[model samples]
Target: MNILPSYRYQMADHKKSILIFYVVIVGLSLIFGFSTTLIINGNDAAVHGSTSGNEMATVIFLFVVGLCTFKETFLISLQNGVSRKTLFTAKLLTMLSVAVIMAMIDKIFFLLYAAALSITNSQVTASTFYEALYPSSTAGAGPLMLHAESFFFEVLLALAAMAAGYFITIMFYRLSKTGKVIVGAGVPVLFLMAIPWADQYFLNGKITIALVKLILTAVNTPSHMAVTCLLAIVVFNALAFTLMRKAVVKQ
Candidate 1:
């Protein structure tokens, strides 16, 4: 089946929200930069090179978009006689397209942030999550390399986040009301209460330490993290497809 219609639909669904999210975020960043500059000029503080991890907000935003994308789009696609395969393809395309667009915008925003920092003589530093993740690699890299690396990594990271969100919403959709309640409550309880408590008391922090060590070792560099993100995206999307294949449309 032709995937254009479904792809276009998915893109259209996210366009408005993405626009508003960026607009609000950029506006806030500008206000923050200028305000901080004003404060510095008025005071005798000598702080320099303050790091802002604000770019991480994009990942959270994409995760929210993923959570919101599946249900309505799935129902609409089914109503339009779109097969699950076609719909899934369209979603993949939509994710890639949106991720690239977002990554480019983020790069441009970083440039703007740098300019703002220079013009206003702000001490607050602007950097990408990629640089934060792989500082050693970024430290000696040229501007061109840093930008290219960040754009690619952010695209992968963004895609992975969305895939995770999509998988979660689809999993919820596949569950019954009682199952939903169990998962919604149980997962948090397991993560926030049970696991943490057990790890602290019974396991003596072994679990948390081991998990952290493993994550840190495995994702030591941007390239390594990119692979991890790719794996996450693939696994999550594959699982989502399995659920969507048998998903029954409901009101």
Candidate 2:
């Protein structure tokens, strides 16, 4: 797989995509980090609390990195010569792995920033810092990693969302020229709408909210809210993938 044309194809496209992704990632990080530093340092707000800017950035970074990496994973799978089912499985696995790594990196970066700047309360030690950073879910498990429980549901949701996107792109690839325009514009608009709807309907309301909160927090944490978002993305991806698999490719 390492030297496969599929892998090479994926990597080649990612060169440009990764550059663009990095630019956005760095820009967002700087903007959020600076704003957080200013707010924490300037305000009389409790630094160690959940409302910290650093905390917000940590969550944002996880999501941004997860989605970004997932896109690359999907593109990479296209380069690997495989059946649609195989591609889907490989891409989903890669995306999940990326999400976990991104979460860890975001966590570490947030902690280091807090420690270096002394933005946290003096009472919060490094060991306690992690616990506070990743508070226990209502389920009683502290968090995914470093804990006995696995975030399997969360992982599944992330893969589902990514699969949905890959399928959507393939669907677009099969469209007539006019249909392509409709899809290009329509899909993103619907996606934008879905973001808030997922929050209002799934994340905060109904059995979905309780189910998630039971397993994770729906508050400010990424780990808390990501599974919900990923599920929404998954619903779209499943439909898209099904359609794409049936789609007629001209090439």
Highest-TM-score candidate: 1
lDDT tens per residue, model 2, 1-251: 43344434433433564356446765775676566666666767666423232333333433444334433444445554455565555444555554454444445654565575556443222332334444554335444453322233334333544555555556666678999988888778765676557767766655455665666555355454565566665676576557646654354
All candidates: CA RMSD (Å): 1.6, 7.8
Please give each candidate's TM-score.
0.94, 0.49
lDDT of 1 by residue, 121-215 (tens): 66677777777767888999998988888888888889999999999999999999999999999999999999999999899999999999989
Number of backbone collisions per candidate, in order?
0, 3
Runs of candidate 2 exceeding 4 Å displacement? 1-81, 119-161, 181-237
Model 1 spans with C-alpha error above 4 angstroms = 49-54
Worst 10 residues of 2 by lDDT: 49-58
Name the lDDT of candidate 1. 0.87
- Residue 232 CA error for candidate 1 (Å)? 0.2
The C-alpha local distance difference test score for the whole of candidate 2 amounts to: 0.50
Instruction: Score candidate 1 by TM-score against the native.
Output: 0.94
